[model samples]
Target: MIEAVRVSGLTKTYPARRGSAHVVAAKDVSFSLAEGESLGLVGESGSGKTTVARMLVGLAHPDSGTIVINGRTRERKDHGRSARLRRAKEVQMVFQDPYGSLDRRLSVETALRDVLRWHMPDPAKGTVRARIAELMDYVGLSEKHLGSRPHQLSGGQRQRVAIAKALAVDPAVLVLDEAVSALDVSVQAQILTLLNRIRAETGVSLVFVTHDLAVVGEVTGEILVMYKGEAVEHGATAEVLRRPRHPYTDMLLSSAPGPDWHPERVSELRAAFAGTR
Candidate 1:
């Protein structure tokens, strides 16, 4: 399988308030995604999972390291129009909050059409409308939805629109930064199923970043366990979930709600978490 994204020695740092003080957001982080493969980045809050996602989609620049997308290395400064455009075409991001991500003022048609104009300008003007309708249908939306504003839609509908917008560019990699985290449990399940169906049909690599291990295990085959700006453990989803090597990872799994919650596990996990802190 061809690698869709390769990050080697990826690092990011922020200046602290004190002199010569700095906060490391990500350090020596490395991972890769194969075409059509889903990799879940699991970590607690401030674990740099979202930072990695931002870097992958070019929203945030790494302090040091290389981001090779589809075999081309992306430069931090001025990445040039050609490089920026290429990055935009190949990588797309789905934000955590669907309601917040959409522009309430714009109709679904306008939202999608604007992205099409920016990313896929070569399509004929007449065909663009047809393509918009087709995309809406692909994401389980109807013509009536095209005229509706984001406020008129439910959370699930809004998320579907976000997915449609990401698909508009036909990107090779979809970086989902807590994409379904805001939805209710039932809605989250539906969205996860939708994502799986889309991936199976379109063959797009999915980078699912989330704090919920159970959610990640449901959708992703591979897992990258991140803690304190670094990947503590990397392996298959089932293996890592079943037999977590890192203490932080074990704590996360044990703390995650399950059908039969164990008080002993919760106590153990809490103790582990306190120790880490």
Candidate 2:
């Protein structure tokens, strides 16, 4: 399989106070994805999942690490603006907040047009409006919604726009941070279906970061469990969820609602896991 992304010994630290020790956000957190494949990074808050997403998209700089996207190695700081823009075009990010991710002032067409204008030259092979129409169509949005602002559409609609914008650049990898967490259950399912279709059609590799195991199960085949800024477990999604070897993975599984959910079982798992620590 062709490698889409490979991250080695990635770590990031933030200074908290002048006298106090620094806070570590990601510690030796490393993983990789293959072309046309999907992987899920699951953990609760402060698990450094978001930090990993930020690092992948170049939104945050890593203290120490190696990130190779597609085939090019990424520098921690030395890549110039043009190089960074090329990287950005290669790997795009779809943020969690639908409304917050998009500019409310711009209409749907304009929002997509703005991204196309950046990556594509003026008078691009196709007109900007024509490209915008294709993107909206691909994302299941009709041309009638072209003039609608984010507030005018439902949460799911706004999210579709975000996804379209990410696809605008034709990136090889897409880092989706809780992309469907804000939508209703039905809407979430629709979005997931759309994503699966997109992946199947475009062969775009995905790095899905979310706290919901069920959501992860639906979209990803492989799983990486993170805890306290470190990767605690990694394996096939079904195997990990069915027979979690790590305490953190087991704890996350036990806490989730399921057909066999028993109060005592979760407590026993928690107690056993705590004893190990």
Top candidate on TM-score is 2
lDDT of each: 0.89, 0.89
Off by over 4 Å in 1: 18-21, 79-82, 273-277
Clashes of 2: 0
TM-score of each: 0.94, 0.95
lDDT of 2 by residue, 103-158 (tens): 98999888888788777765756688788888999999999999999999998999
The pairs that clash in candidate 2 are none
For 1-277, candidate 1 gives per-residue lDDT tens digits of: 8998898999999888767777799999998988888999999899999998999988899989999888888877746777777887889999888765589899999999898888766886688898898888988889989999988999889999999998988899999989888899999999999999888899899999999887898899999999889999999999999898888888888778778779898898778777876
Segments of candidate 2 deviating more than 4 angstroms? 18-20, 78-80
lDDT minimum window of 10 residues, candidate 1: 76-85
Q: What is candidate 2's TM-score against the reference?
A: 0.95
User: Global lDDT for candidate 1?
Assistant: 0.89
Model 2 per-residue lDDT at 181: 90
